[model samples]
Target: MSTLEPVEITAGSLHLRPWRPGDADAVFAVCQDPEIQRWTTIPSPYHRDDATGFVDGRSPANWATGTAAQFAVVDATSGELLASVGLQDLRDPAGHPGVAPGGDGEVGYWCAATARGRGVVTSAVEVLCRWGFGPLELARIRWIALTGNEASRRVAVKAGFAIDPAPRSLPHPRDGVIANFWTGVLLP
Candidate 1:
């Protein structure tokens, strides 16, 4: 059995925890915000149904499959859903792909509009990264941001993700052509 850990983390005003059905309403409300739709890949006309489906369907399935891990980032003090963070493409935790099997993982995150400019996401990201590198024993964590997302880039930089010298192409929602991407790696 792949030992899965139950994770709950906190930093400053941010708290990270697993998703629940009740989060559907909160996610729907946040997704409905124009800023989220504009800056992220979420559907432009995000509806309650979409959020409900994500909470009740995709999130749980990911947990069961052990392919991904996602956490809802909330305000520790207010218990407001402020963002989401996760790790993907995990190989292992110790730098070896086969023996002890440590490899690269991807870091992804997004913050609610109201949570922007408040340092909430940044603090939360730091906490999450520490957990990924420490308890998860991940060898490397990669961060990628869309070329024009300066806000996201700032968050990445703040969370120890340095910009690469050259950008690469990454998938984009509105644009058919691959968009410019910034990549950073945290190595153990």
Candidate 2:
């Protein structure tokens, strides 16, 4: 394992930080939004316990294992969490399959209902990708958005992710098939 501990990431209007126990309420509030449950992998009808586990267990557990990095997106001024962002499928950015033992890193993010349409998520994602590409030595950063997810697609494009077709059956966190996917590479 890299033994690189998770740390806070800051963008202009957003900060990506490790989730704290006190974050449960804010997180739960965000999760409760209908749009969140409708679009993202978060369980429909997400209960308080889900938020608890996300804060107290999931994020910290990933750090301990060095397998994932999850950040709570917060307002830069107030330090209030507005959403979550994650870098998953840990591996180098060099596109080397064998030399890099881990899988390709995938960036995932969501914005709070209140924060939607305000450019917060896009700004956060761009900064996060830049940080990941440089220090993490990433070969390619893939952004996958389900078809018709215009918001996600727009963010990827704004962040310099080129749109291209990816295989269907992309194994969405939700139960059904995702007919289309968009993938973009961060060129060296």
What TM-score would each prediction reach against the true structure?
0.86, 0.86
Please provide, for model 2 over 1-188, each residue's C-alpha lDDT reduced to its tens digit, 9 standing for 90 to 100.
54347789877777888889999888888888887786677878999999999889987887776556788899989987777888766664354321133235778888888888888888888877876776666666777766777888888888888778653557676776545555665543
Cα error, candidate 2, residue 46 (Å): 0.9
Give candidate 2 regions above 4 Å deviation. Answer: 92-103, 176-179
Candidate 2 structure lDDT? 0.75
Model 2 clash pairs? 93-138, 93-139, 94-139
